[model samples]
Target chain A: MSRFPAARLAGVAALALLGFLLPRLLGGSAHVYDTLTTIAIFSAMSYGLDIILSDLGEISLAHTAFFATGAYAAAILVVNYGESAWVGLAGAVIAALALALVLGLITLRTREFAFSLVTYAAAVVCMNIAANWDFLGGSDGIVGIPPLALTLGRFSFVAGRPAQFWPVAYLLLLFVLYVVARFRRSRLGQAALMVHMNPRLAAMCGLDANQVRLHVFLVSAPISALAGWLYAFQRAYVGTDLFDTYFLVLMLTGVILAGRRLLLGPLFGTALLLGQKNFASLGAYGDALVLGTVLVGVLCLCPRGLASLWRRRAIPGPEAPSLPGGPVSG
Target chain B: MNVAQQFANGIIIGHAYALVAVGWTLLLGAARLVNFGHGQMYMMGAFVAWWLMSATGLPYAAAVPLAVLVGALLGALMQRLFLRLTLSQDLVNLMIATLGFGQILQGAAGLAFGAKPERLTSPLQAITLGGARVSCSAQDVLLVGATIVVFLGLHWVLRRSRFGAAVRMVAEDPPLAALYGLRVAPVYLAIFAFEGAAVAFAATLVAPRTPILTSIGFEQVVMTFVVVVLGGIGSVGGSYVAGLLLGLYTAFFSALVSPAYTTASVFALLIVVMVVRPGKLAASGGFAR
Candidate 1:
């Protein structure tokens, strides 16, 4: 069962190489390129929340704020300051980091619903400011973002078409997936699990729960923001709609759809969701209904998520897998 | 900008906030449950009332009670769906479930009522207060009176009634209350139904003041949060006072500074409060008192 590290690395590389060809292998149409590129971008966005929701065992509803911050930062830099994609990416990370610091400190002591409430409020505040502040283009939002151009000394890559953009988006997704995998193996990840599953045990083990939470939050925001950075170039626009609940719900649904603790869960979930939106073509209202129903149904009927459903069937156990924090015994 | 008129307007706004928040106050304080779909439910209430009045040619007053009834039914439906989660006190899942329910409601409203904004008109909106220099609508007067009456009634019920005592007992410790022969599920269902009915009632009174939209679901409930949090979480009387103070704060802030930033400012205040004193949201003994 224990494979050599070199073999595992080769396997991962092969899979990534295959992913680069996935769009062409599927349909080879521009629509396929556009759809796959979106899936990759949104999946990257979902991974940010996946780390927090699945590993840290906390829901930061303000992930949308981070996502929006990146888009806006990238949009503003490219449109207003004529900055390169690299600078825009830097701006996104810095803005999200600053926001996470403030939010993390504010919500350090709060647990459960209080944490969610504060984060949700923070996201709404960001939206409100974005909607009103003319410097951010008010409701009109920042537009005319130039195509992403990352250049280095006589070598340059410009992503002006969906096919041209696919590699960048795919690379970003792979990078995020690598970061998430590395994070799951890191000491901070272990500490976050301890803090979530057993607070007293975590404290006794010499971990500061709040510090772990803050660190994890600080790390998580830039991941989503990076996705947004790419997304701004793809869309050529950034608006307050980036902070909408639809994105939040979509992110949450993606994280939980395939199951927690699985690295590919959110990626697969996002692909399925966006695929449905792209191919099936439900009107907006119907799409919302489907997304909401899926989220609620998963949490209610199969709390371990869809991945667990097949696992349960394969194992054929009488005693079902218990949900974390089961029933809170009195 | 007339100072007295703004002040009067602030009072009406304050009462409206309190009324809208009353159901959430009970749900949080008594049931120890959170509903993220709260704003959607309020949206549903207003739309249902609007639909009834428009389709049936019913009087605005008559449509309100019917809308409250529908709200109660919706609440019951939610309770039915979430009974398991409620029994377990799974706050996180419950919150998300409510959000899903709200999404469903929003989609349904969009399909049924369309996306366009519609005004919920009341006959009382036409009746004006005196002097024309500093005045309000009769609907505003009705809202203020209704808020006072509801608060007083809730206080009386929570403190002096047997059912309220049962609810408080459940809130303090559900398993223990169940062991002592309390029918826990029914209590939860009743509380949810009350939440729906009360918020729906608030919608009829308050929604007439503005144009209603299904999209407002996401943003409409922030003021309710400010009221609930500042009012000491589950304290009914506290929420009333908090609502008035917040209404005044928003009114003055909008009048003096800019209305666009008022929500951001209030949320900033919420962040400060969470940091400074989170003890206000403790899970016990803060109900009607």
Candidate 2:
């Protein structure tokens, strides 16, 4: 897919290096490391939804459930079984996939608002279960999660602080970015776009739309789960708050803010949002108000996202900037 | 178990759910617009009335109407913001925009009302009806009465009135309605305003039964979704029946099964219905029916 593979590889390496040095370049305060690590983890989480929203052309509000599933799974595995972070990662993936499969099948026959409503209800039900179920620690949540420890035979590294965690978070973010980029160019990715844009055409070409949706959903769940696995360690806790609408709104805004289908859009969007919250927060309510306003404003004023503004100005004509899969209004 | 008492409780709760979901039913039936913010709007309505009564010493009767007016204005404002998307028939963006609006309302409510839960007391709540077997507060009676009146009035207006015809026409085909000189935009605006007002009215009446908090909207919306969907996605009469059935089911389920998992059980019901009869979800024929 790349015209210049060598140059692209070099570019990726440079970006990774810069990302790793970003905290130190900002004086390497614990706060800086913390903020950047959070941005990375969250952007990775957002990417899971990014594929579904941007490429698959559907809104699954249940992504939050997949996210929460990952965190809860990791917390349960590590906290209850005294397992390693590797096992926690495996548990997170398995649990998230199990959830994604059920949700995918339940919603397979529905579309548009029906799909959205069901997914949303599922997330809410998940949250309620998390809060009320005694086996999951009830409302108190599972705390005292040991710091993330990844050990191999005769070699080990642990992340117990924000600074120490930055590398792991950054690596995860890069891995996610690479995976998303590749997925966009993959056959399933192409099929998803085709199914979204022209279902009849896709069908004529022998594509099973439901199968593609289910496959895409299965692929997306583990990505968010990976982020949650890391998050279980970052906060040293996993609570029902992981299923908050705030996170759902955040993922949607992050995916849409910088324009869909862009590899770096979610990452940049997450950075901008987290940067504001970290440095210039106006308390909880104020921050929420700001986030909500930004989401609404961006959609109302620039439905094509901020990237389109520059394109429109550069092209100057009655012709609208041609979106990749047409206007996402549908 | 006192089956009679639970039955009465179910009737009152059913009416409350129906009242809460009426605006959404109209919006969906007439305009095919989904307001994810409906729950937050309910939260705001309760808080607005509570704030008015507590802060200005206004009577509950006066506070309710004032809050309804505010909700109407908020709805109109939302319509204005969503006008472009609505015009373009961009359902996806419209849905997300409403979600953002809901978040904004929630945050603003938190800032304005504080995080602490507040009670929106009614004078009628102090008055009990019926004897020991199946007693309910006057407020509950009022809620049931108001719900019936609103549903009957809405049913009449939608089925028999000229304005109802125009709304149904718009819902059926916006372009054709506009070609026939229906003034489509005003119909949408009016539908949205009614949605806001109706939900606020529901909030004013039903919110007194529980403590009001910004966070309460989350659970409230889930119930609303159940009613709307089970009612066949926009059926005014169907929603009323669905709400009643759900209320009875909830009452008995909480009593016999587990109160903690009621929402989960209700959601499971929705999933089952979706799987068994997916076509009902896509059908919009309930507007006129």
Candidate 3:
């Protein structure tokens, strides 16, 4: 009855096996599953966003800024310096994390919406710069990114083929989820949840709100940046479209409209979104009409998220109040 | 014609931004909820007014009133349906919802009108004044003049009216306002609607001059934020002054520096402002966790 950790392990193990088997079972054609792989990449990024949104309850509007920063950094290194894909990916993660840390320092000082605005502003600035700089392919984006490679494992994204990337991709997802779950189960995890529950109380209990925010925010960026690195690698392309308003909206849409309750919310949301690519040709408004309407309906009706509808509950009269701004528990 | 002309252009552009920013400041002053859809209302005003002139064969005079009405109506609906329900709720949720709503609007507009830019057709013709060219038509004048009147009217209402006192009470503290016999709910809705209209009016003022594109709303939203930030959050004068200043900043920056640097410069200034005085550039209420 109480095999929580073991259950968690089993769940993760099943997920890893599924990810590993996904391409081989669904391969031989670059269709829905291929798109699904890309969706998985977004799900990976959403996991990063979860550090702030799900665990800590911070509303970061400018996540794409860091993601784009990672992508552009990787794009610049590879496209300009003729660096190896591994080198570019490493630079992207480090640069994106560094930028996120610096930004978090300034924004973490402010509370909710102000932090969101600061992040949005940062994203806009990065976008404007990217659009203007012709050197990094400017608005057209830096295309022709090379694939991945491992030294001893002899794994190369190029030689590995789409089928070859299955293990690498699954491994990346497994590592991300395992690390996040571990962190959530750690002292820092409680501290983070505590910060979300009530920062003032957390402060009263000798927790530094700013410090917690900085750590969570810092952690959030690398995961998102890693998503960006994977985005460039998997898509074999990176463009200005990835940094614009549409993309930014997608991140939030993935989070709020879907991922409000469950940890895997973004994955489901992205899968739904990407699955509608075929419907885009229905009209100019196309999938947006459906997506936006669904989003509004969800927020208006089911603030906890669409995933909540399927879950079971026990004796739900009135739970205690959430930390001041936590999702109104009662 | 010259650098001075560029300066004047910047100032004129800045003034328009100030008008929109002032609307933002007013709503923020009232409810402490930042309406992301405010820019959409602005774009709508412009487009709708343009439609009346071109399609309905209405004069600039008729179009102005029609546009204002549309702006006000849309604003009220947004509040009644969206903002009022979400007041004191998660700011992030509201922001994301607005983005979703805005996307729906964009997609619809793209379907209805097309993605290409549409120029407002009016009796007004371009003519030179004071060694500079201005659209001497009634449309341009109406746009500029409407902003002036709206600003003055807003100042009067905020300062002197009984309703203004109630609005101020609610803005300063909603629960406290209830203690004073003011109904906070209606006020929030009213303030949201009022600001939405004001922004719509500004958009109409803008739409006649600039071409309308489905994508323009995206940039305008950020620009509005810049105006609000530089204007000192809820301060009316701050918003008014900041909008014009930012407009001037953008215009001259584009003229003297590269066009690409114009948007970036404002953001850089925002970063500087954030670093120097985080409290000064604060969003509505307190953004604390």
Candidate 4:
């Protein structure tokens, strides 16, 4: 594992630098900046789900609720309470954590389809509340949100345009990528993988599977919320549309597209998805069809994901024995 | 609000809920498969029937059967796509795949039908029972009758038919059934096709009461979930009773409380059931008593 520490670090740094300059390299147009920023923010959003789906092996459909909570928290705090971006970020995390705690508790005993169904029902209920409640602006949604503004004493920076916001979005994505990478190596992360892969063995090792799930879920929610925190500023509005199944499907597709447990999978998957939507455009419905097809196709044809195709070709030996039954069993 | 009217309304809506959920009940009971796309399939069913009527001037009777056929075909296609995952019992991927299938259906319906809300008209909608006191459209009567008939027929088929025995065997243990020389794949295909057909039939019947949209399925399916879970997760008789009870609860809640929070309240009911009896959810019990 420690064989090429210096070289791997160098490669990661180079790649990060290139990702930062990708928009500029693509012509530095407003369109380019907007697309890249959207990609970054959405990628960050998908990472939250990636942790649970990849590491914890449960699909919490209510991640959309967490994402919405983050956006709504940011919007309500800044637009209504007159707070700064830092405060908004704090609010987003707290709100998402509280939601995650409740959801985690409710779903603690359930697994597989029951967990998914409960979480899905939770998201739907949240949407109903958002659409009906006046505090969240009812059906109209809270609009006219000011652009990203951060002030530290006398120093101030405001990002009102796509190009100006690119750095913050990029930095958020990088931070999320770092956290996810570290989480994959952390003790809790190992515990989560153990619980997911073999609850009986994990129990024999004196681990509480439910505790591991709750903690992983807690860790995962805020990551998505942070993305939603940035998303509120990026869109300049927070609406009920945030709760659309589109985001849920996108997150699932992103996590599953390139392959699960791969650090760059969601980021690459999101980039490809948003790239198609932003540049090689299909109208909304057409794009939806494409997204749905990709998700179904990837899971059905190659559960290991698109990356496995090349990996198989690159190393032709006795084929790896198939997984007996798991989410990403290839 | 008129109490009798609410009671009548509840009964009719209960039947609608049961009818809508019957397919899912069978799917879960027979195959232990969960379709996140069931709601979208409901949406498609309504839209197909609506289109058939409007486009071809077909009678509601003819259009509905045709829509059910289309739905059965769609179900078969989904089963074909998901056959590998289903066989492996890799339920996690199967669930997500169904969600994708739902998305594809929604997008296709939106493109084909456009965003404008359309109504699936029933001639019987004009007729009413118990004039002015607790009246319901004749269509509501049909809904109730259809629910009873469907339930009775389903009960008989599962209890008395060879196909029912095959489904139960597959549901109990797919590999074991295969080893016993049962063609597990055909059983799965048939179950999925039945799910599609039943949901479509429910859609054609129930959708006339409300404005139909590609998006209605999003919330519409929630009640079905509540019914399925509360009714014992694929028990046909239990689902019927649960649907009726939920309908009554929803009717009175909307009447006595807030209409907007009905879905929220229904979900709260589901959560309570899960917390109280989590074991019921994980177990896919027998097809009948």
Candidate 4 residues lying further than 4 Å off, grouped into runs, are: A325-330
Model 3: share of real contacts kept:
0.54
- lDDT tens readout by residue for model 3, B216-269: 776677788887776778777677677777777787778777887777788788
- Lowest lDDT sum, 10 consecutive residues, model 1 chain B, at B280-289
> What DockQ, between 0 and 1, does each candidate earn?
0.56, 0.69, 0.51, 0.73
lDDT of 3 by residue, A1-330 (tens): 256989977886787777667656765465644565666677677777777877777667667877877787787887779887678778988987788887887786777667767777677777777787897678788887777555546543452355555555556666677778787887888898888777788989999888988888877888888778777777667877777565665666677656464656776786677667542434636566566666666766666676555542544567535432235311
Tell me candidate 1's TM-score on chain B: 0.97
Shift in Å, residue A317, candidate 2? 5.5
Residue pairs whose backbone atoms clash in candidate 2? none
Off by over 4 Å in 1: A317-330
Give the candidates in order of DockQ, highest first: 4, 2, 1, 3
Q: Which candidate number has the best DockQ?
A: 4
Candidate 1 per-residue lDDT over residues B46-109, each given as its tens digit: 9999999999999998999999999999989989988887887777677777878888888788
User: Model 3's CAPRI class?
Assistant: medium
Candidate 1, residue A194: how far the Cα is off, in Å? 0.8
Residue A67 alpha-carbon offset, candidate 1, angstroms: 0.4
Q: Please, what is the TM-score per model?
A: 0.97, 0.98, 0.89, 0.98
